[model samples]
Structure formats: C-alpha cells, structure tokens
Target: MTSTEAPLRYTAFTSDPEGGNPAGVVLDASGLDDAAMRAIAAGLGYSETAFVTRRDEAARRFRVRYFSPLAEVAFCGHATIALSVALAERLGAGDLLLDTSVGEIPVATGRDGSGAVVATLTSVPAHSRPAGRDELAATLSALRWRAADLDPALPPHVAFGGNDHLVLAAASRERLADLAYDFDALAAVMREHGWTTVNLVWRESPERFHARNPFPVGGVVEDPATGAAAAALGGYLRALGLVVRPTTIAIRQGEDMGRPSDLLLDVSPADDRVRVTGRAVPIAQAGA
Candidate 1:
C-alpha cells in the first residue's frame, strides 16, 4: 500500500478465482519507473498487468499503463476489467474513465443479478480490413491450418479495437479445439503484421461462439480471455455485415484450457464502438 510494492492479483471474465485470466493490479504506481513496472510484470508472469500511474478520485478518472512479461502493451482488456473490479470493491460501483496509451476508455462497474461485481468497457472506435493474401497464407501456414479449414462466411480480417487482432473463423469446433502451432513462426507473422493475438473462433450459433487466442507476441502461449480481441471481433462482425441487426453475442473462451471464461459483447450497426462485459474476482494470496 506504500507506493505500490507487490501487485494485487485478480482474475477477470469469470466469477471463479481459478477460472479466468489472472492479472496483477498496482493501484498506486506513482513513483515506479518503466523498469520497475516491467520487472514487476515479468516477475509475476501474467499475460498483462495494469499499473495506475495517476488517479483522480473526485473525477473518477485514472491514467494507467499495461505490461506483459516481455514488454509494455498499448492496451489490455482483461487487466482493465480486473483493475476496475478491484477499484469498485473499494470505491463502489460506478463509471470510470481510463487514460491509456491507445485512448480514453470508459468503463462502468455494477453488480450483476447475483450480486457479483461486473465491469463493462466501451472500446474506442473500431474497424477492420481484410487480411491480404500473403498475410493470410503466412498465418495459416504458421498455424498449420489449411485454407480449407477456414469458415468461408468469416473471411480473414485484421480487426482493431484498442489494439489489432487477426480474426479467423474455423469451419468446425474441432479445428478450434486443436490449437497447436509453431510458436516462432506465428510470432514472426504477428510481429510483421502488428497483431496482438490470433483470434481463432468457431460459431456455435448466431449469438454464441467459442474462441481461443494465441498470443505469442506477449510471451504467452495462450490467453484464456482477451477483452481487446473480443471488442475487435465485434468490429469485425459489424463491419463485414455479419450481424445484420443489433445483437449481443456470448464468447466462451478458455473452456479447453479449463479456465472457462465468459465475455458478453453488445454490437449495434448504429454505432461503431463495442461494449464488452465480464465479471472479475480477486485471487487470494498463497497461504492467505
């Protein structure tokens, strides 16, 4: 509590402590430099950790930074949710405006029907473009997946929320479940294209889907729940006219990994921004 020592750990996108992506939260990182934050994030070994550099209690505004094990990231969705839930526990549920490297993100925290704190984040302007032939081929090769394995309906696209993500839809659930890929090759492709994660998904229904994210760039083999990618997906779907009308989709991630996270996305053609909602829970310290 004194100038941010060890970070407070929390899991996002799920109610269970053990069933979501875990992130470290440094509530007051006022004095810590970049090196210190990077070192703390690397030591914790999470996909991403959030540091609150400045806070305006009266305004409910905060400036934050995110770091993965390898380096600082522009933005991170799960960490944002985790941090918001953590703050809500202390400040009570309401609205918060976060100043991040990408842009200002508006987040609202409230209790769900079960009385569990849930955080909903509105992403910045979102958009997407079709992945080029060479880019698609390289990504498919790196994933060891053939072009035939892709779903024709969801063409390959590079989508953006706060960050960029490669969205690929699998033809079947089996293809989505089998996720072994060449780490070095995929990482190279991602770096070349500036993709944060490869969002591999399978459509179960009009409003439900399963997703898995390969995040080699962040030095993680996989991400259980990715909020930024989810927002990007909403943009992708809407931009491509996949969702003809306003609707909400349920994205089930990390089920294969046994973490089992749930993310809800509200997408409307009238607006470009995506609303992603999820619940976060604090992780008890070891032997606490």
Candidate 2:
C-alpha cells in the first residue's frame, strides 16, 4: 500500500473496535495535499477521516483537516475523538488545540473510570436559528416524514457547532427507528442549505436521547454516531431555552445500525460551546 493508503483506523464514541463511527487518521499529513487526503478518505469509505496537517509538540497544537468520501468536511467530532485517543496512546494524554476549518477546538484527553482513554472536545461557539417553513418542508419530504411525526416541543432548527446541522426531533422512538429516506433528494436539499447532516433524535428522558444522522451530503446513507450533530443539538436546546440549567446528556446512537455508539454532552445556559466526550478504540488491520 502507498503511504496515503496506510492510514490508522479507529472507531470513535465506543470502546469496541467493531462499534462506533470508524475514521481514518493520518498523524503526519503535512506531506499530503487536498486531493491526496480526499482520495484517502474516499477509499477508506468512512463518514469522515481526520488528517493532522501540522503539529506543534511543544504547545500541543495542530492544524487538522477532515474529508468525507465526496468532499471536505468543515469539522468532524467523531474523527476528532478518534484522532485524540490515537495520539494519547502514543504521545501520552493531555490537552490538544486543533485549528479546523470552522475555528479552533480544544480537546482534553485522560483515562476514564475503566482506565480507557477518553477525549472531550469543546466545540466552537454554537448557535441556532429556526428552520424556514419552505426549507423544513423540503427536508421532511426528503426524509419521508410528515409534520405529525415531529415533536411539538422541539421545533425544527438549523444549528451550528463547527458545522451546520438540521435538528429534527421525532415524537416517538419508533418514528426515529424507521428511517427510510431518499438519498438523492436529501443530498440535494442538504447541499442547497449547506447542511452537514440531519440530526434525527428521540428524547427518551430529560437527560437521555437516541439519535440517528442522515449524511447523504457526505455520500454516506447514515452515520452511526455524529458528534458534530450532538453538539449542535446541545446548542439548539440552549438557544431555545429548553435547557434551563447546566446538564449533561447521554446520547445513544448507532444502536439501530448495530454499532452502538455513546456520546456524552455537557451543555449550560450560559455557555455557548458544548462539550462532547467519547472513547475510541483502534481497529486492527485485519478488522479494517
């Protein structure tokens, strides 16, 4: 295999190699250009892959880029977690500052209760806006969902946390589970709106939620786990005053996909940046 093809593979948001969102990590991608990175990510067939273009060991800072199979992604949360754990295993756990397309993201890595390395990423300033009626109608049409399927409490909104995500809350867990959508239609709508993903979620309780993301814009039908979307959800709740106080939410995703990924989100009424934490495990060559 060529140097560009030999990226380290890891699955984020889960400790098991077989679960979570798998991402390709190129530790030293300084030599690779945009085309090379895109090609690598395309061949790997992951939702997104992370490339560390430049690293400053002294300051623990790096310039990173993310690419999906079809295009460059502005930011990717799962890939960030995957890369952070990979770095910690080799360089030792610590704080890392990543300069991304959107803005700088701060990540902290340390051992969890299970003695497994977990990474928490503080997203860039997050905000949300109500989705226009026309836009919401178009998106719902693409997803084959009707107005009745939506949760009245959580209105449709376009949220930003490094990238733009359309947050749609389902009225029931059953509605969230039955995901059948037009890929081409959804891709066209997402591209037109410059949306990174459609965050479809069902709130099980005050602090727990189940989610699924349709990433047609990335050439992926569905993402097992999406950290960017999770962060966006937090921002959406805060912006709408849904979160009255500081809260930590547990997001269960990828269960329907059989990947079973978990994401922890911390959000506060006063804080604009949301914190997402998850564990990652390396995927062996044979498994990859």
Candidate 3:
C-alpha cells in the first residue's frame, strides 16, 4: 500500500460496536512527523492512535508511537492490540516487538479456534510504592471520598508497568460503583505526580475484581479497558500476597459506563511482570 492509502484503524478489547476502547491505527507512519501524527490522532478522536514505522525487518520489530487526542502518551494497550491485529492480517500471527518510547514491548498474536485474532502483551517490569500521606489525602479530597471509604487491606500506592497509576481499593462494591469526582481537581493532582490514571477497584472474590479508572491525565473522564492498569493491579496483588502463585485473575471493568470489558491477567511466581490478554474486534468501517 502506498502512503496515499487510508490508514487501517481498529477498536480493541470488545466484539460489540459500543463496547471496548477504540483506537486509531496507521500501519505505516514513516513519513509523518510529530505534528502530523498528533493531528491525525486528534482528528480521529479516539482515546489513542498507534503509529508504526519500520525499524528492523530481521528482528520483526517496529518503532511505535502512541498519541492521544490532546497529547502523546508513553504507551497505550488498546492501540497496541489494534496494531497487532492489523499486522497479523498481513504478516500472519506471531510475536512482534514494539519499540515504544517507554521501553520495548513484546506482543504475541494468535488466532482462536474460531480463527479470530487475539493479542497478548507482556508489560514492562512492574513495581509499586506507597503513596505519600499528603498525596493520598489530596486524592481522596478531590474525589470527595473519605479515608474510611478506602480498603485498609489494600492501601494507596503508585503502581508502575509501562506508566504510573495510583491504585486505590474501595472498602465496598458500592463505593466502587459510585463514580462522581472533580475532573479538574483530580487532573491537577495527577499532573503533579505524573500519574496516568487512578485505578479504583473492589475485590469481589479472591480471583475476581471490579475496577474503574479515572484518566484525567489523558483528557478522558474514564477509560473503559485499561490494560496498563491491569498489569499494575497484578503487581499490587502479588505484592500484597492476595493471590497464590501462578494464578490467573479476572477483572471486570467499564460495566458502570455500559461498555463492559473483561481483562485476564496471568501472574507468575518467577517474574515481576504481568501478562494481560484479551480479544479485540474491528469496528465497522462506516464508523471508522
């Protein structure tokens, strides 16, 4: 395909039109500059757009960049899924190395028994640290949530995979369902701390969880399916010893917003990183 051909875009993490997160895809963005890429992403108006440029044919790696409508992001999972599916269409399913600005991300793609492509990304090394007392207080105040509403077992902390996220476990499912917050107020705190999203979660069972993410830093009210945050949560769970070793956990998100998404997380005892897997279907062409 020539540069004049239209870009290939796809939504990730859901098979339905209105479910999952939408991402813009440009299979070849070799000639596009930063401004041009940003303009395209802004024009597309998705949460994020993935731009790929050839870097090495022998290694099957490409230099990738992610842009939000408002600004560039270090990494975006939905976009990565979309790009991987798109590439699989041409090169067939296998593993591809994505050289992102943050780090090198390895994505493995394969087809299900029904022949639908699925992509699983192994995130960068995961780590978590306790949130400062003042920061936690400020975050709660901005969200209008009292300290007592927080789950004492899980404490407030900043978790990092490819990006940084603040993990807050609510005391109850009721608290997790209530999603009223000061957008700008929380945005200010996130900006100050360079956080990507506030990962609010409620544990439904030992292996199941419900989560919501407020993504003020990305200029979005909330993210429907956050793969990066899922990786962080896996790290947090492992750190807290909530789950046994070599177990798979399920996370249900975006239900409150009506775009229900399911994320499967694989945690291993030997590694600190987490592997997140999900299915992504292409949005209709008319909508694209």
Candidate 1, superposed: residue stretches over 4 Å from native = none
Model 3: per-residue lDDT, tens digit, 1-288? 544466666767776758887888887888888898888888887778899866565677989999888899998877888888888877889999999988889999999998988889998988889999988998999899999999998889899878889999999999999989999999999999999889999988878999999987777898888888999988888777765679899999999998888888898767888888887877777755
2 or 3, greater by lDDT: 2
lDDT of 2 by residue, 1-31 (tens): 2344589999999988889999999998988
Full-model lDDT for every candidate: 0.95, 0.94, 0.86
Model 3 misplaced stretches (Cα beyond 4 Å): 1-5, 55-58
- Which candidate number has the best TM-score? 1
Range of the 10 consecutive residues with the lowest summed lDDT in candidate 2: 1-10
What's the lDDT of the predicted structure labeled candidate 3? 0.86
Residue 167 lDDT, candidate 2, scale 0-100:
95
Locate the minimum summed-lDDT window of 10 residues in model 1. 1-10
Decreasing lDDT order of the candidates: 1, 2, 3
1-288: candidate 1 lDDT, tens digit per residue: 645567999999999998999999999999999999999999999999999999998899999999999989999999999999999988999999999999999999999888889999999999999999999999999999999999998899999999999999999999999989999999999999899999999999989999999999999999999999999999999998878888999999999998999999999999999999999998999787
> Candidate 3: worst 10 consecutive residues by lDDT?
1-10
Choose the strongest candidate by lDDT: 1
Ranked by TM-score from best down, the candidates are: 1, 2, 3
As for lDDT, the candidate ahead, 1 or 2, is 1
- Which parts of model 2 have CA positions greater than 4 angstroms off? 1-5
